[model samples]
Target chain A: MKIVLIGSGNIATHMGKAFMHTGHQIVQVYSRTLANAQALAKLLNSTGTDSLEAVVDHADLYLLAVSDAVIPEVAAQLPQELEGLVVHASGATHIDVLDKFRHAGVIYPIQTFSKSVDLELTETPFAVEAREPADTSTLITFMSAISNRVFEGSSEQRMAMHLAAVFANNFSNALFQVAYDLLAQHDLPFDLIRPIILQTAEKVQNNEPRAVQTGPASRNDQNTINKHLQFISSNPDWQSIYQKISDLIVKRKENNSEN
Target chain B: MKIVLIGSGNIATHMGKAFMHTGHQIVQVYSRTLANAQALAKLLNSTGTDSLEAVVDHADLYLLAVSDAVIPEVAAQLPQELEGLVVHASGATHIDVLDKFRHAGVIYPIQTFSKSVDLELTETPFAVEAREPADTSTLITFMSAISNRVFEGSSEQRMAMHLAAVFANNFSNALFQVAYDLLAQHDLPFDLIRPIILQTAEKVQNNEPRAVQTGPASRNDQNTINKHLQFISSNPDWQSIYQKISDLIVKRKENNSEN
Candidate 1:
């Protein structure tokens, strides 16, 4: 099926490339910048269009892979009599936001993406929703062409997933920053933590993370905990974070024991 | 080299097996329990002993792979006229604690170890230190046989690495627990987040995690943030964690912009 991707940002760049590799025609690429649109369009062998009106061309799906703030306004700009099924790839934005389109749906990929990222289809989770059963099926089938796992989730469920992604990906990445800062302050090379970080991630795939949790906080090793607390005492923000997360871990372990 | 392993725990079991696989003689396996010692000892065709005195036979190295608190007393129990090098594998414990022995060193593997985890050689980093230069060389050579990467890190550096490992491994795993809890509370399978978790981990291996940060907190998507905060408000601990981590991300972004 011919697909028109309506954004030339990170997600669109990677997703469009993945789709192209799978032998799907990316019909057109639209972005606020003609240069970006043309660049991605050229890569996909598709036409470039900065104007939303220009996206009325031939395509089976129009992926509104734009920012969350612009999803509704972008939908309003599309033709009232649409030529194809329209979908936006926003995770937090609701399904109803796409209701203005004659045929509308969502294809939210739940993964952290960037242009430099070389992604495989199996690594991406496509969370889709649609106004009608056939529309949903159509979107799922089209998505399954390039990806094996496609999930049917409600807008509310998708929102929950979006929040959870923050905890698992974005927030977890920030914690990496915290670790970097703490080590840097001690004049330690950030590279020393790299191997352990990779191993930590690998461990979860084989076992539950909680059962594998080991540290001053996990062991309730007060001596090391006190030392770390004193080490980070200068930074009140990190200190509070350390204290709260530690308390939470202990509380959760206690709760689990009760069960 | 003949190695006498003390404590038949996770690290001991794993390292013992690695040594046995490398065709090194594991002279003895000592633990609190005869059965546990026998089980691991049999794998390497070595004697299992509950009595530490009886097990301190003719070996080139005595590797004390035991709990952090037990190292000192264990070292004290050893006879003064020893004929082998002595070392403890506790990351947080000081190498000077083994000063009672004429020849003492450390062989601290920087990766998390479990008896069940089959570690790839190139992936593990070994941090070694010793009072004498020859001792360090012997330990480094022994470790290099089992691992590809070996670095000379002082006990201080290893302790710092151990602390950093807590943030990288334990804290990250705890965040995973939070992700699991948030999903489980909403009647979603913890499995749904597995792929996302794996991808998040993979991204950081070759790239800076700070560079790939995303989601509502990173974007400062106030609407979505407000909605998630509302949803998690009932769980006050999670609510605090969510708020603090969000604030940290936003603050860090601001800090990066200034620099």
Candidate 2:
């Protein structure tokens, strides 16, 4: 399968490598910055271009791995008569953003990608959606070649999944940052909490997160909560976060008990 | 070393098993309830009792593995002239809570423990603190037998570490619970986000968490943030959390740029 990668960002670099590893031909790579396109193309042994007109129109797939805000602008740049299945690798953007193409779809790899990190794509789940049944099957085949986990879902489900990912990955990491900063303020090394962070993530794999939740908030220990709130009083932002999240946990526990 | 475990809760159970595994002699287990103590004692091949007076006085160490609120009460119950080094396995409670003892210390393992989950304690870091130099060395040797990672700090440092753990372990798990609940509401399987969670945690081991943070919040993508806020409008608690955390992330990012 000949593929044209539409961006040279972190997601694009990872998806491009995964596609190439699966024996697919990356015929062209495009980026607004010529250097990045050329760098990725050099590694993939593909043509690199900064202009959408230079994209190979006859490739089997055109993967738009750009940011959510740029999906429309990038899609508008493609030749209106291009002959390929056009797909965007965004969880938040709706597939309708690709409606300019005759054949449009989405192949959202539901994992955070970092250019320096070598991720194992085989187990990473891909959420696929296409305007037509045949296109959906093509996406399934394309994605299955790179990953073992693939599921069909609508834009609503994908967006919901993206929101959940934010909570699980981004928001959780933000909370970790909070912990890191707190420890740093006290001259405590971040290593002090690394084991606990790893263990907390490991526990959720087999147990329900709610069942495994442990802390003052879960126990409704107001005294400790008040002490923590007082400790972070200097930082109003953290104070609000601590209070809000604690309240949410306590409320959820109460609701569960009432049920 | 002869040891007496003075609680039958989750931490006590895990600590008892770890001590027994290291070939230490768990001479007695004491709890407010005889049955609870006996249940754990039976597994460690030791005596169990409800009365504090029945606790073995000549043990090499007395481990107070009770709740933070009950630490003082339990410490008061112990015979004032007891001959063993006394330690409390608590993060929030200070070593001073056991001031009644001639020799007091702390053996706070910095991980969330559950009796159902078999944790590998050898890699889990233990934070040790003691009033005397010899007792600190004794505590270090005992902790080193069960874990390769051990550090010494003051009671103030332990409380701070405990607060950090709440953020790293408890608060992060709460964020996960939010994601789990969100996924459940959408009729999506929790498995969809499992890989992402594991990868997110793994990324932090090698990178600064602040550098690795990604999401609508970190990106300051207000468009997606507003969309998510609208999606969760029915749940005000989630809405407030979404707003507050996003605000915090954006504020932190802006602060970073200024610096």
Candidate 3:
């Protein structure tokens, strides 16, 4: 199918290159900024257009890989009587926003992308949703071309996944910052905590995180917890975080024991 | 140098094997539980003893690899007139607990160990601290035999590293539990979020965690943040975590910008 890329951002650049690498035809690239569109278009060896109105109507898929807020506005600007599946690449946006189009769906990839870092699609999951079964199949086919880990999920499930990712990815990354800050306070290099951080993440790949819960709280070692808290006595923010997470771990462990 | 493992626990088991593999003679394995002592002793071809009275006085090193709370009690029970550098394998415990011995030090390996897992010492940092410079040299030499990643640190620095590990290893691990739970609610398997989790950990390996911060909060994209908060409105605990971490990221970014 001939694909028209919409948006020349990180996701767009990544997907465009990936699609081109897989021998798919990207007919045109669209971005509000012509230079951005042309840059990506040149890479794909396709035409570039600043106007959404200039997006080729003959393309089989027009991926509105724009930011979440601009999805609806971008969809609204598309040429009428389109003969293709119009999909937005957003985890949070619902499919209803593309109601103006006859065939609409979503292709939400669940990984943070940096164009500089090569993305291995075999591990990156693409949670796809479509209004029509046929379109879902189309997405699965196209996405599977790049990645084997494509699944058809509902809009609610996709958005729920977006929320879940915040917990899994964003929040966990912040906890890393907390660790870095703690080490920095003592003039300790981040290298001291590097291996353990990798090991912790690797552990969860094959094991359930809850089952592998560890640390002073998990061990019910209040003595060490007190020592840590007192060590960071000047930082109330760190103390609160430590106390709350510790209490939660202990409380949860007790609950599990009772059951 | 001959070594006596003071406990047949996780840390002791792992370090014992690593040391033995590196051709260090494990003279004895001591555990309060006799069976536990014999189990580890069998692997190392060393003596296993339940009575601290039976702990050999001829060993070059007596490793107090026991629990933190019982360190002093266990130290008091060790045979007097011992002829080796006495060391405790604890991250949180101060070296003072082992001061009863003429030669006291710490060999705190900065990695969580499980007997079931093969510990790669090249990545596992052993932070050594001794009251005397000669003892610290002895420790660095011994530890460097198995792992070249040995460094001399003060008691305060070692303890701070312990607290930092809690944030890096433990708290971040709990966040993975949060992700698993979120996915479980929708009957989604944990596999979907596995790649992102690994990537997040890998990103911080070379870069500062604060610098590599990604997601809605990192972008300060209030639109998605509001959507996410509303989505998890039913779960107060999840909401609180989301809001607090998001606010923290936004505030930290502003501070960084000002600086």
Q: Per-residue CA lDDT of candidate 3, range B73-132, in tens?
A: 999988768879899988899998887788999999888776656668876888999999
What's the DockQ of model 2? 0.79
Decreasing TM-score order of the candidates: 2, 3, 1
Poorest stretch of ten by lDDT in candidate 1 chain A? A182-191
Model 1 agreement with the true structure over A1-259: per-residue lDDT tens digits? 7888989988898889878887888988999899999999998998898999877556778888888878888888887777788888887888888786778898888788767777776757788899999999888887887777797988878877777788888877887777777667667776766777777777877677788777767667776677777666678888787888888888878888899
lDDT of 2 at A42: 94
The interface root-mean-square deviation of each model, in the order shown, is: 1.8, 1.0, 1.4
Who wins the DockQ comparison? 2
Stretches of candidate 3 above 4 Å error? Answer: none
Looking at model 2, give its docking quality level: medium
lDDT of 1: 0.81
Rank all candidate structures by their DockQ, best first, as comma-separated numbers.
Answer: 2, 3, 1
DockQ of each: 0.57, 0.79, 0.73
DockQ: the better of candidates 1 and 3: 3
TM-score of each: 0.91, 0.98, 0.95
User: Best to worst by lDDT, what's the order?
Assistant: 2, 3, 1
Residue pairs in collision within model 2:
none
